[model samples]
Target chain A: MPFTAPPLFPGDLFEGAARLAASAEGRLSAVSEAPARAAVLDALWEEAAALGWPAVMVPEAQEGAGGTLEDLVAILDGAGRAALPLPLAAACGVVPAMLPAEAGGVVLPFVASGEWRVAPAFAELMRDPRSPAAAAATEGGVLRLSGSVIGMEAPPGATHTLLHAPVDGASGLILLPLDEGGPGLRRFERLDGRPSLDVLLDGVTLPGTALLARGEAVARAAASARALGTLLVMVEAVAAMGALVGQTIEYLSTRVQFGETLSRFQVLRHGTVDLYTRHEAARALVVSLVTAAAETSVAELDARTLHLAKLHVGRAAREVAEGAIQLHGGMGLTDELPASRLTKRLLCVEFDYGDGAVHAALAA
Target chain B: MDAAGTDYAAFRAEVREFCLTRCPADIRALVARGGKLGRDAWSRWQRILFDHGWGAPNWPREYGGTGWDLRQRHIFDETLAESDCPPQYHHGLRHLGPVLIEYGTEEQKRRFLPGILDGSVWWCQGYSEPGAGSDLASLKTRAVREGDKYVVDGQKTWTSHAQEADMMYTLVRTSQEAKKQQGITLLLIPLDSPGISIRPIRTIDNWQHVNEVFLDGVRVPAENRVGEEGQGWSYGKFLLHHERLAGANVAPLLRQLARTRRLIEEGATEGEEGRRRALEHRLLLAEAEITGVRALGHAALEATLRREPLGNTAAVIKLTSANLMQRLDEIALDATGHRLVSRFRPVDGNAPPEGMEWLQNYLYGRVRTIYGGSDEVQKNLLARTLFGH
Candidate 1:
């Protein structure tokens, strides 16, 4: 008998993604800089819109396309395979559920070591403690906004910032109009050439409704949401690792050293085996978690499962990513190659919610 | 599928009921205490199944077995595993019995098969020697032909249950000049024969399951050789195939996991959500993998019953099952915390609960993938079967 498993998803999601990934191969190869990358991201957004990705999670009654969690996983798996650079995971996972619909595609900045940073572009900035972007409270009917959020980014068509804050003695999400925010908002050019900004919210008066409730309920829900997004990031990292490893294996098969293909060397074969093993381990764990989330209804339990998946996948991702680079010789580190891009993205994903150390301590 | 078409369901229910009654209360208590049965208990348990004629369900009826089909065999294995019953002496039921049935003379079969069925003669395998383990075909245990006997000399290491065994079935080199695969012969040697000695090798887990058996001019009658002279290589290979099939038992793992789930549920507090969920997730994944293995095993057994070639797919089952066993033990240790560190005590009231079995199983499981042909060897077999040499 063939080694068959239960269908991971109900319908054509996996198949669709696989096709898209195959078709976009040339497009992905042509893209080099952030401007071209942003255009590719726009094209991806259009494709996602065509697939109704944004509406997959929304309830059918709430204008959603009536897709399940499995559907979302399939779509993300596809995105990973295609090496697409859209923030679909964050948008679908974090924004619609955690923040209000008006927030409009929030770039969820991750907080690590008391520093706030946006991923895919890890630019660090100092918090302006005097601005509404640093708002910590909303008393009575007035919104007492203070402090600044560093590492804010305004991509090509992004209209607003779905900023995160420690509000009223609790961490909450807020929608900040980037264009309306004063000189407090300073734009910084990133190494990856993406447009990022530092928003200062000093003594800004705002309506109570502007404050998204940072209650325990919201925090719990948001954390769970963030976990789902992190899971996709992990899936993407695995896919990229797969591609790089495949390419390296192909190169080694053709490249001769000492009168034989590099692949013929026992040492290289063993190293490749190690890489494959770690990659499979990560894939197994991630797929298992995705299946778990689909089959269960317990939110807290799902959150925990996602956390463990992140920890395992993060650690494996780093190893596989680095292994891919090492195997590719000096070409792996240069910007001219895709391996470096994968490495950078994987590094950012590793610290997105928490690193291996943070999650491991929590899990333990 | 109709209810009757699914014969496994009915067989599973029947085996479950049998285990609930025939499995000794003490054995259940031991399992409850996270202990596996010792040799003595296992013998009694085997006899219980023998009395019910359920012993050796995988063997043919002519050889004192149930003669069940593949699905039934799977049901029996699944039930046995889930019940946490004492492990039957596999050396007899899984290894020697099948080998003898296929290759033993009628007189040999009549004498040994019944004893194996009744648990009267405990069996141990003497395949691995001090000098030959992974390179098993290169065994140097010499068996020189005498007038009416073969003089066996050399040592066998890692002989399971050798201390308690009444007889041992061994592979010995019969001719030095013949190719490694050509000059070997299989001999059934009595453990109590003069010049045969056994010394226990205490492993890191402090268990006595393994032993080193030395044969200094031990002599066995000519009738003890199962097949033709210098044909032991083929017979040993056949025996290994059967052994691999028997080793792919996933039921015990399921039972252990069920126990782990209970322990986690009972011990962990409501606030320990992360640990609880992680354990639960692992349990589910294990269940899925075990189910997959069961399906694969059932398919292999069915092919065998139909007189079709199993090829090297048997190795696949063995490989997957060994991996699952290792994973289950790891999860068990993780679930029990420091309890795993304690030594194992006997199931009897006078002896403290022997917690050592879990540790022993963990250590033993590490060698499982390496033994019975390393996983790499199995994969190579698979690759050859798929792509050819």
Candidate 2:
């Protein structure tokens, strides 16, 4: 059975969330036991596609599931708890939040069915000092774009990337397809075993439809997408921390030394309590972000809440990850147990979008 | 200011208007300098609130409060802090008034609620004795039954503002036959009662912020006892929860952070480039912390508004807010740069440096992590809950 977190806020999404969580938990269990990355990722993607996971935030008029951000949060939270090595949040959350229904109809279907996968590069655009400086020109119903973005955590096997670029003195959202071994594209491995891409787009050509949005619409959509993406990353990290906290407590209760279980030791118990409190604090930040979102339309995102959630949840994830690993003693150091896997996922989540230093600078 | 589907924007504007226009100028200035608003000035502010029907934001309407929800209360407090308005006298209003409503008898409520609402009476908490701080259940204060009164004898230490208060809600040992927590009783003792003596305790800031009160054969009527005999422990626990949540007050920290920003801007012209950058970085982290604490406070408020148990979330807020307060104070002092070495005799004729205020605030903020269940104590409480069956 999947580990279900209590609903942080009351909503109609819980029913759909319960069903999706169970499906995700079942598939992730199988993925965790797989011996290799390539086949495991493909199977995970196919299973998610069959389950219609990526279309959760798309509008129903676009032949998609048509769910709210709350629904997407529940799905990504489940993915985080399972430590599913996929860009579920990026594909399902940021993409839908960023695209209008007309554009969503065309792009989401390919993404939902696993024919194409996409990861968000908004954080890179925000943090990388080297501006994408992307300029776009319309050429007889086609678009030419050129920009360079660094530190993008491109999901393994991702077929496309979504980012914002300046076009004609206005911000434009661009969706670019990836060509295997393409020039100006540098691929590497991330700390969490995911693929990282540095794309140097030089006069790349695409259909006019690739300019998903421009001007004020692009600004609002980008803000909404960034806010949604940050919160979703927090949801996933907090979910993983929740799982780690439970696992650590159980380990403490079961592990024995010096004639007593580790839980019975006051020092150990207090250390666990610190970790639990940090996890709860992060969870509270996520809840407040959700509440703030509910109070206003997602397009008019609350900047302070968004910034606070990113900075606070990022640090909390790091502390909980290190503390959970430390508390498990010898077993925590090994990949056989879920502790290390969960820790690695948490560390990856912490650095994925702006990280602590980047966010701290923004906040400062 | 929108909350619970209601737009609090109008309410916020009304509060801001009152704080900016109606609050007494001297009183606002007093609060701005971090000066204590003694009984008279506090009563003047309370009268203003009472006249405006904003006397008690958290109390029930039946008790003459504004009947505002948690969001309104937060807005009122935040707006007041932003405007440099004197904070409410929370001892009787926030701490004792709620306990009376929850567990007090009709008579006790009738006698105490009005005074607290109208700001006529000042009350200090008497739960801590010299020997019974964090491990409070082991208190040696005794209260033996004597006809129509309870003869109370105890030494309560750290009685904040006791000298300016009229009554103290104390915890006394009523029985020896049960667990340490089970044998205590909460009683309200008038400070003027016979055989009660108070002594001021000077601190690091050389300010008499707290006092030591000795209750020797002080007679408090039996009617003053809250709830049943041997039930004070539970009531005390409830009050402590309220105290811990209240201790996470975010308004003053926000004000301090703004002040730090001003200090940083003022220092930028004189400081070296690298030093200014370093201070700005620290200020950034502090700003992030203030934001986090404010969000946590909102979460706790939402939880309370929903009538949900705050549980360990309260502890988390208390711990983090306390840390943030001290951290902000340090940043403010550091922003003062070379003026940091102005240590001198209090009686000296030399005028204090510009950093004197920050120095005093830094000294005063030391109690944030040490009071209202210290950081270690909160950690232990959280641990017990996690480990409990």
Candidate 3:
């Protein structure tokens, strides 16, 4: 039988996100310094936590909405369109999906190589500067582990860390209490001024039940979930880029240059048209990927689809972001404007899950 | 509705069986090797098909054809495409046969239609010239009146199968004083006429299927003109529509994609994640593109079958079909890796199959977007027809 797109939800996810963003348009447009931005991030996290978006994908038996991966992707895309400061896609969408049903009240803080520093309080300190170290794992069921898991963002009021470690020739994910983890736990400041910490597990022990069983299965599930979450993030980024390009076109239409509106220039119009074409191709490919993933049960096939989607969408997002900034002129680069923030966010998204080149090579 | 009612299940089965029995083993091998069958081989195959009365399925019943409807035509085309049959000389069957049936004099029909069906005379097109390609109306090929005959003298470039063709269906300038598009006439000229020269233009990839024909004062009887003088434009336009319609078939491309998938699957290591992923992605994209072509082609065929006038959007279907073929070639070559680079030579008076066949396909596939009409021309036609630009 021929395939078809699934039934669309009643409300347009994008319009709802746009409405929410419009309510806070002033704050979103405001240029805030580092300290104020950190405060904003904190407030945004609380708001997101209140919304229970992080638990949306978890089963209903475990306090989640019992939503499908499609639902989480839609929510994350909405968040992206709103340009929300919270890492809801990672912390909520990916984290909950990775953890077991009963593993609640534990926030999974995402970390990358450049986001935090590794302290020498752990049993074995190894750093791969090339790869992102999002979470740490303990060797045993050592709740009070004697090792330092560094380069982690300490989401406010988190009780434990979902640590990933290689134990007994098998990689496992273990939950470790943060406060009671001895001198191994030390806080560090990130470039974005977010609160991150290094937990040093100095031979601390814990109950054997603390270890998350089926480490390999959990790791694979986490990777897949993260990939799905990243897909949503990439989609959201494309939507934002589309909106930005539209706004730039409107601005250029009225902005006079040499007694004529900038939009009156043929070159400008053609350039925007070219941008629109790229955006359309990327959007179409992404939608196809989403549809394929929703329909296909084949894991490797789905991964291939996702890889192609990511490669095309990532490249298009980068182009759109750069074009928006260039078209906006010198004011675009300023901290006082939202364009620079959007540009930074887009750059971060381009490399968030995987770079276009990496994904293209993978797809290839 | 019943499932069998919507599907041509029975017709498909019959065609498949017929192909297995009637399709010659030598021809099948030649097609499989990607080589063109020689004249004798083609004659044998055509006679076999004619014996079954399936030689000219697209022709009207009055003209020695079965006169099947659109669905049956589609089934026949699809079966032939999926089979190992050699490339049927399209100039006779696709181009000239339709033109003669549509606008030919009674004598012209009687003289040429049988040769087309019996594969007695191989035909080639003489449309393009050095100065007139995409803007084809500006052809300078002159055919001046000389009593009961017209002397033809001009050059036609990009003439397919001309080197082996027995006859040339040419558009000659019959009136220079008339408007640019007016006063041209279509004529059937013998390719072996004195002062006629056929020279192969080696393509970038060195395929010899295409050539350039120079008409140096070749004489042709006035009776050879298929239609009224100055009506060549209309006939040519009709011929183009037929060509585009036939070219829209996607079965060959679909078969190529299936072959490519098998090749990639067989070559890829089980644990080679990246290469396997890439192949899988390419396959999906190809499938999607093919589906799009099928959807568009079906719509167009339905419209034509209903005897409804197809608006200029026909160009859109043609453009998409050509693009799909080009993309299929690109993917096939990529999948084949360096096997595509190997040298090829024709054996036993038949074209080589593996390396040179693919190289030729790659090279000729580029012209799909250029010939019949350049892609840009199609797009412009679509723009005008759909958007009134």
Candidate 4:
């Protein structure tokens, strides 16, 4: 009856990640609050990298673990459950999946080794491939990139960015250093108090080696990255929402009014039940999306299903979080309760990538 | 596991074929057209399921039930619901049958069980009185012991299908000396008794599905009492649990959503903006349906493997499905931007106009949350059980 659901797609590696996240729960709260410094981020990344999470979706031959999609998903679920407060979502979801196998020999070790923290770009580009936000032109055999993605802001302690641009009349991936932004990178605060960046690759130069994959391969990697991103975030969402609702249920049971506990009120009980079902459904939908795709390579993951699942998970998370707030009444919005944190996290998740409305159109 | 899980794939295929092939075409047509079918048609459909021993998939097999576990029952229900099969009439089949199987005496079972199985006798509930509903322990419908018979004199309101029923399962106050709930006794009263009268109460949907039953000095032998005296409250709650099982998923909402999507695709909206709105709401309903399916899967696991009794789950489903069902209809109306026409006639046609149906469905679906267990009552019960206040 408690809100936690059985892990729908768990593996031995996922179990290890879940345990690691559990052990590091209190320690990672800072990652979500502020962008970790180079040393702090490195230490955090090394701890996770030591467990080989970054290499989960990469091939083992490329100095990676060659883990299944479920490994990445479970790790994200654990991180989100602990509210690890890091770019772990991007680290596990976008970075490894987006870096194509073709680029693994040159760049894979750094990425797989957690030496690079590549902030994702081209969220807007993915939606409108015809007019990508970033454009590229080659000069002296070096690619110069210029284009700005919406919803990007420079992080306080950023290193690398997985920038997507138009290369050779097709979408291509490039690893650009964040500090050399040339004034195109704008930084802003995300809902969860994390720093986000928007970058204009104007006059930004990438060596020919920075061209990871072009044509179908780049597009495929980008799509895979986005799909995996949604799925992993959803795993985190399920936990956060579950914890929030559980706290709400606990509050309703003890918080007394009318000489009776709120839990004794059928209205509140049924409302929590409603939230419970939503959490359960989101878990089932997301687990299916991740586990099924794990059977195939990341590039083959279905985007439409991922979009539909995200749409559902995002809405369900909001409902559970908001309903928890509403039922908690006065204590809901207060920082004393985790409901405050969950509400903020839910808002962030909803707007991340394409929201329900955007996914709806794409699904259509 | 999902619907595509290997364990249930074949079972789903079997149920799907049975529903598609065996369900009556007229009933299917009535359902697909968003119209009501005749009672005889409903009974005929039930008879087919009865013949297959699937009339009550959750019941034990020895008493004409299918003896399927939770997942199998879910597959059967989902298949039938999606096939546009007329919903099974539940007055005698789902509620009272389960109660009787669980608590009825051997002689009582012999007398009543077969009738329910054969789909012959129709029964209606007689729990809600003029004063007692959500707080049902306070019911005042009284019965006085007279030798070997109990003389009953009271009224039951919101008696669904009372006009068509041959018998009524009632809760009457037998003793008022101790507690409100402890003094209650359940009696199976014949609706055809000399002093019994049934009056129709039309709902907001202009449907006469529910009624008021007036009992004046109706006499029933002591044997007609279900189980022991002073246990009616317990039996009623059990019956309600059975009734609420249907709430687990709004699978039927999927059809309404599909129809709405088709309406949008067929140019139900006027402008580009309106079309976009229609598409957005349609997809929202789709997301809600996926959520419902996921909940259904988890509920099945809990009920089957964990042997968790259907307490919070039924209420959760009821509350959630009611809210979603209402939302689904609004989405349909949003697509068509239709108002209920004054002269809409759903009965005369194979398929009513989409706008009219959407409007009617929207209006009628308004009461789904209020009936069965009212949303408020369900919430209170779920709160108490889930958190143990």
TM-score computed on alpha carbons, candidate 1: 0.51
TM-scores of the candidates in the order shown: 0.51, 0.51, 0.51, 0.50
**Candidates sorted by TM-score, best first:** 1, 3, 2, 4
- Fnat, 2 decimals, each candidate: 0.00, 0.00, 0.01, 0.01
Worst 10 residues of 1 chain B by lDDT: B340-349
For A117-195, candidate 4 gives per-residue lDDT tens digits of 5677663532221233677766787887765554442223557777666786687887777665343544444444344
lDDT of 3 by residue, B225-311 (tens): 988988898998887667656655667777777766775676564334565666678778978978987877777777787788767
Q: Local error of candidate 4 at B28, Å?
A: 0.6
Q: Ten residues in a row with the worst lDDT in model 3 chain A?
A: A113-122
Give DockQ per model, in order.
0.01, 0.01, 0.01, 0.01
Runs with alpha carbons beyond 4 Å of true place in candidate 2: A1-364, B1-6, B241-249, B268-271, B306-308, B337-341, B348-355, B386-389
lDDT of 1 by residue, B206-318 (tens): 34677889999998999999999899989988876666556556666667667767766774654346656776788789878889987787677767767898776678878
At residue A262, give the lDDT of candidate 1.
Answer: 63
Pairs of residues clashing in candidate 2 = none
lDDT of 2 by residue, A186-232 (tens): 54433343445566677677888888877887777777787777788
Off by over 4 Å in 3: A1-364, B1-8, B36-43, B87-89, B269-273, B342-356
Residue A32, candidate 4: alpha-carbon lDDT: 31
Each prediction's RMSD to truth? 19.8, 21.9, 20.1, 20.5
C-alpha lDDT score of every prediction, in listed order = 0.63, 0.71, 0.61, 0.67
